[model samples]
Target: MDVPAGVLGRLRGICLGLPEAYEEVAWVGVRWRVRTRTFAHVLTVEGGRPAAFARAAGTEGPCTILTFRSEGPELDVLRRSGPPFFGPPWGPEVVGMVLGPNIDWNEVAELITESFCARAPMTLTRQVERPPG
Candidate 1:
């Protein structure tokens, strides 16, 4: 199964909107990168092809997975959120989210923005307008 067009489109809008961010075909799916650093990646998992991701998602069936960067309190929160959220077995700061009809696009936008900032250089990150905390 492939990533749904609407979900991919929404991700494109969020990820590409970042300063100097670019999209490319990843090993299994699509990834958005800032320079050489990938900040966001979306792919479909099926038949436990990617063992780690399949296990983390707790399913062998087809499912869309989005992996992105996170840190500090946010990372901790997402890691403990369970279900739709899981800690991908890669970078310590990398977080994986399961995409479905119930996903909150606004939250995905926010997470993608944060991931961009984490991977982008200071000069580029400074140009992004983030919500006041």
Candidate 2:
């Protein structure tokens, strides 16, 4: 379950707005942020189980923390067996599919980068509010 360094670098470069962390071994995690706010986190490697969490911006607050499965079928079984976590409406769910088994690491990295960009706040421009009379 080891991803190449070059792949990781490309992903990070695309997400310069956020900080991405890879290769934490058993507890490897990737955190996506906007300026200083956290938008999402992916637990790439875990010794105990397979799970992940994502956070969306412009919401009431931090989401309830939806759980996602990695490696396809394994995650499916985990969900069916009454796991502590559940899936969230983070994406089309095709991400894990493209990454795992399919061996499409490049596509996976690109998808992740796109997701981060969509989640991250606009680095330019500001919300214009009209002055109350």
| Top of the candidates by TM-score | 1
Candidate 2 lDDT at 129 equals: 21
Residue runs of model 2 more than 4 Å from their true location after superposition: 1-7, 17-28, 50-98, 101-106, 123-133
Looking at model 1, the pairs that clash are none
Q: Residue by residue across 19-87, what tens digits does model 2's lDDT show? A: 332222224445445555433344433232233332221122122222222434643553344323343
lDDT, candidate 1, 1-133, per-residue tens: 6778988999999999999899999887899999999999998889996778898778785889999999889999998899799887677899999997799898898899998998899999899998667
TM-score of model 2 (CA atoms): 0.35
What TM-score does each of the candidates earn? 0.95, 0.35
Q: Record all residue pairs in model 2 with backbone atoms less than 3 Å apart, i.e. clashing.
A: none
Alpha-carbon lDDT, every model: 0.89, 0.37
Model 1 residue 105 distance off true place after TM-score fit, in angstroms: 0.4
- Clash count in backbone of candidate 2: 0
